[model samples]
Target chain A: MEIFLQQIINGLVQGSVYALVALGYTMVYGILGLINFAHGEVVMMGAMISLSALTALIGIGLSPLLALPLSLMLAMAGCMALGYGIERIAYRPLRHAPRLAPLITAIGVSIVLQNLAMMIWGRDYHSFPQLFANRAHQIFGAIISDIQLIIVIAALCIMAGLMLLVHRTRLGRAMRAIAENQHAAQLMGVDVNRVISITFMIGSALAAVAGLMVSANYGLAHYYMGFLLGLKAFTAAVLGGIGNLRGAMLGGLLLGLIESLGAGYIGDITGGFMGSQYQDVFAFLVLIAVLVFRPAGLLGERLAERA
Target chain B: MSLRFVGSLLFATLLLAACGKSATDHASNLLTVRIGAAAPLTGPQAHLGKDNENGTRMAIEDANAKGIVIGGKKVHFELVSEDDQADPKTATIVAQKLVDDNVSGVIGHLNSGTTIPAAKIYSDNGIPQISPSATAVAYTHQGFKTAFRVMANDAQQGQALGMYAVKNLGAKKIAVIDDRTAYGQGLADEFIKAATAAGAQIVAHEYTSDKSVDFTAVLTAVKAKQPELLFYGGMDAQGGPMARQIKALALNVKFMMGDGGRTPEFIKLAGDSAQGVYASLPGVPLEKMPGGKDFSRRYEAKFNQPIQLYAPYCYDAVNVMIAAMQKADSADPAKYLPALANISHDGITAKIQFDDKGDLKGGAVTLYQVQQEQWQALETVGAQ
Candidate 1:
């Protein structure tokens, strides 16, 4: 049916965004064994930085062709610096104190980032200026906008690039060595701190891209945009196996599909008692189910081996 | 690294900040009375909140220029503004802060969700509270004697919307969606009842949160129903994006919005998609109001921006409260409370009078349609 196909396209576009953000959480957890709750704020900062930059650039009469990539690169670089600084200043100090200390600090850092963003951007919702030509393409009576198509293709390409980077590069081997065992990796003469910082920078870069995508998709951004998104991405990470790379991707796409389909069909499935408002309920339910059935998650071998 | 150290550090800083705002007696040897205004001075609704504050501020400035004598003394009125952030929890905190500051009266807590919770604090403290924009019917239903509004309630606006949609716009099959907030959901429920009563078929109903920006899933479901029109009960922040998504999905349905959606911000967000959308406002169009033309011109002269919705209502609310004070010859709310309940004042919006429940009497609703990127008044309903 056209309706079903339409929902599928919506899900795929949304799923890629989730997967992009999920990669940040999984990579940090893979290295630091800390959830880095502040990762979401980094995504917010990314959106804010890029949005502000793009608006400023476009306002000064810069063409979209040059302005778009320039703003994106600026956001990625800004987020990378911010990611490195936060880990160095907040997480590094509490690394050895206790497991809960770093966790608490991560939450504190998230709050600090949110308040800081409020101070900078104020609390109004800034609508994303339309930059790209989002022509609609009809497939079998289902419509997919050009922006949606770009999101899917761009996400796939990014994921593939990340896969090649982690498998083929020396940095990837060092990252895996540290995730296997921090002390053991250090004993083996690997620069654990450098790799950890690199991991954070890489993850934050991905978050920046995801932030731009989300703002462009929804056409709105605000100081508080990162909270629910970070939460859902965390759910995706947990569902996929916290430390596993590929699992995060699988979990993100699955969660997005589940949310879209559930929102689309819940009224019919529940005989009209439940409505699309319960769309968020589906994501949380999937989280609980995944934790209950498979504590290790769908691809939980990484967590098991690390333990 | 010590938790106690961090905790104590945070506590000390907060203590100092709280102490700085403690109310102090007027040192100017003049009767300084603070009038409090609470609205979402921050967050997505800040524009509306700022409008309320600006209206209140202008009223205070005008009152000061008049140098009115209250209780046989020249009273200098000061405005105490607080940001509720459009959150209910923050509204209560702002209310308590205003009460602690010993304000003579309160102007607003903008949304119904925030206004209702904040009303209790004002009522308990015997401080009169007037909301310019909160339309939820439950606001006055709680028997809060201190609560009043200058605009029509959702019950009245919803009826006007339902009647206009069916009778004038000729929509028979309608689907309703709301943001699940007090104002949005309550308005949608009322519209559904009135539409059904008018022999219109209610095809499907959907709901989303106030914070959500995406509506594709919900739209897909609603599209299958093939409704002739879709009525949304939510604010502009969500309405703009929802409008765009509706256009993108190419749903062959007309769109209508309630008072919350009838905002300039909504048009900006929806862009080209905002064309042909119908929206309802709870008061007569600004040009049609008794003093609307003069008020709008003067307000823009002072504020340097066009009056968004509710500025005139807020201006009227402040002046009416002051009028009650003048009638009783006292600035004390306890002395003037009775006068406010029974007072009649000609305001910019209407001849202001309240029923026993503090709702506006014979309030009007105006339906407007977006034509070529601007809202044009289509018809006036429920008008005297």
Candidate 2:
């Protein structure tokens, strides 16, 4: 029915951003075996930075058309630098320490980044400026807005570009070699640290784009926006099999579908005993079920063990 | 980083020592009257919290400028503000902190959930507390003599909003959504009761969280019900996005929200879709208040931004507290308690007086409709 179709569209749009952010988790987990929890704050940083950049550029009298892309690029660059800096300061210093040390440090970095962002932006819901004229397109009695459409396409194209870069380049080979065995990669002159840093930079850039998509879709942004999103995307990554690229993508989309459909019909499904307020339970429930049924996850046992 | 940390530590120590000295120094002619204010100053609702704080701060500044004497001693009013983060647990901790600091009176904890729990703390300490914005009916019914609010409660505002929807807007079938917060659920329940009693068929009722950013699933489900009007009981953070998404889904129903969505932030977030949306607030329009024009002009001149929602009510709450202290001729909460219970004062918003349950007597409710991205007042109901 149109309701089903509508849920699917919503799923695709939300899932695409989940997939993008999930890649950030999977890529770093593949190489460094750390969650890089601060990556979520990187996404928050992206939104805040891009919003400030857009306002500044527009204030300087540039047309919105020119300002939009320019702001996005600047945000990506800023996130890339942030990604490089976090790895250098937080992870690199503790790379040889006990694994728990870096895991805890990643959480520390996350808190620091969040507080830093709060201090800069001063805790308010910053309404995103309408980028362009919005047009809602109806398909089979289901509606999809232009921003939603762009979000899906942009996410897909970026995912494809990331796939190509991971599979078809010299750096991709180095990244794979490093993920396979850091010692072996280093012995083979792969510059393991450099490759890992680039992986993080690439992942952070994707998070930046996902951040913009999320803020654009909601028509607002805030300092705390990235926390739940980061957790959900991490769930998606684990659900698909952590450190597996294609699995993260599939898991992200499926999680989004499950969330949307479950939220839409929960009231009816439970005979009105439950409502959409319980929507958060869907993502974790799927995660728990996936972990119980297939520990290696869907399409996980027979692929490259890591991204 | 270490040097900066040490420097900040030393600075904090000095400031604390100075405050300790001030508390003990009734040795001087000037008695410092510290008024503790609790509100969320570092979250999504920070704008409103800051507005409340600014109003409270302005009142203190005005009182200091007047050089008021309490019990024949020159009193210097000081504000001791804390960020409750709008969490009840944090609010209790903040209340205890204020009690420890020996503040003469307490000013807030903006949300009903935070305010209700915090009221017990203030009452146990015998500190008079006033809320400028919390409107949950349960707050006043709790038998806490220390608790009072300047704004109308949910039962009154919801009744006004529900009746207006049926009689003025002619909404026969309605869908309701609440953010599941204390204020949201309470207001929605009251509105539903009043609307259903007035012969409006309740089509669907859904719930989301205060932190929700997306409403697509809930809206889609509600859309299938084919209601004539959709009402949401939540803050602007969720309401604005819901408005935008409602348009995206092309759901051809009239959109309405409670006072939580009646804000400039909502208009900015909802963009063009904000037009035609209706909201209800528990007050006469600012321009219609007794001293509303003068207070608004002074507020704008001081703050450099227009008053958002409850600034005048906050202003009134502070002045009413001050009036009680002046009438009692003492800064002690115990001394001022009787005076506050039986006091009537002319405030910018209205002639403020409280019923036996600490509820504002004859509080009015104003209905607003968005036109060209500005809130235009439709009508106010239930005044004296």
The interface RMSD values of the models, given in order, are: 1.6, 1.2
Evaluated on chain B only, candidate 2 has a TM-score of 0.94
Ten contiguous residues minimizing lDDT sum, candidate 1 chain B? B20-29
Predicted candidate 2 versus true structure: per-residue lDDT over B1-384, tens digit per residue = 697776565556444643431232333565678888888886678878888888888888998999988877887788999999888899999999999888888889789989999999999989999999999999888899999998999999899989988888899999999988889999999999999989999999998888778889889999889999999999998899999999989888999888899999899889888999999888788888999999889999999887877788888888899899999998889999889988899998998999988889999999999998899999999988
- Please give fnat for model 2: 0.75
**Interface RMS deviation of candidate 1:** 1.6
Each model's lDDT? 0.87, 0.87
lDDT of 1 by residue, B157-255 (tens): 899889888887799999999999899999999999889888899999998888777789888889989999999999988898899999889898889
Candidate 1 residue-wise lDDT, A198-304, digit = tens:
88999999899989988887787788888878888888888988878887888889888888898899999999999988999987798888889999778884643
Q: Pick the candidate with the highest DockQ.
A: 2
As a TM-score, model 1 comes out at 0.92
